[model samples]
Target: MRYERVYVIWDLYDGVRTGVADLDGTPHYFASQYDEGPDDYSDNFKLYPVGTEFMRRAARNWNIYRAWERKFHNGETDLKTHPGHGGIDAEYDELRSWLDKQVVLLEALPSLYRAKFRELPNQEGLPGGMLRELEVTWSPSPV
Candidate 1:
């Protein structure tokens, strides 16, 4: 018989804030691990704070919107054929609006952590790449 298991790993780092990624490379919530156990994964696995979280949420929200847009454009899912709902167009718009606010929130995370690690170097050895692979079982992009 064969079996599969799952586990979660956590990492703690100093001077790293907990939050989402921003357009400007800012380290937020540096400490944390992927949701899964030792394996191979590739993704940004870090618990973000409210502001950064909002941004991350927005990005995800937009992704959903984009998917819907593709589906609708490709005639895969339409209101006429699949009535009862107005399709995902409205949802896409709403998500886009929320994403704007999220961007604003994400922009603030860097400033919040600036004073904390101002003197320190920007790049601190964080286990993002390795942890993603170990926990998610996916290959990460070359750093």
Candidate 2:
């Protein structure tokens, strides 16, 4: 049997918002496992729960920011600012908090588990130097 594990890395802005989600809520840039059946996979297949949570939070924030940006730019809001009428500082703070939480979660992962969180190499001009990739590898337990 072969097992499959998925890893997802997200680009966050200043700590609060998610720039993107890998694919339709799936976070794996690269995923592979040896066993095909669930029986062959480890019991802890979904070990990175926090990472998933982080992505969800980031996605939500990103959507909110995008909406705000649109409204502000389109003159739909009474605020006056380059991105919005006001609350720019507040948004930045929110984004920063989100990013900080993400870091905490990443750092909390066990060293053994870090390999499973692999971050894909950045091809875009975007900065991703602060993010760490976790690589996941699976092997059968020794007899």
Worst 10 residues of 2 by lDDT: 107-116
TM-score of model 2 (CA atoms): 0.33
Kindly report which residue stretches of model 1 are placed more than 4 angstroms away from their true locations once superposed: 1-22, 27-50, 79-143
- In angstroms, give how far residue 31 of model 1 lies from its true place: 31
Give all TM-scores, in the order shown.
Answer: 0.26, 0.33
lDDT string for model 2 (1-143, tens) is 22233333333332212122232233522212224565343222222234566666655655565555555555666345433223565764575586666554542112111122333455344233323333334332231
Question: How many residue-pair clashes does candidate 2 contain?
Answer: 22
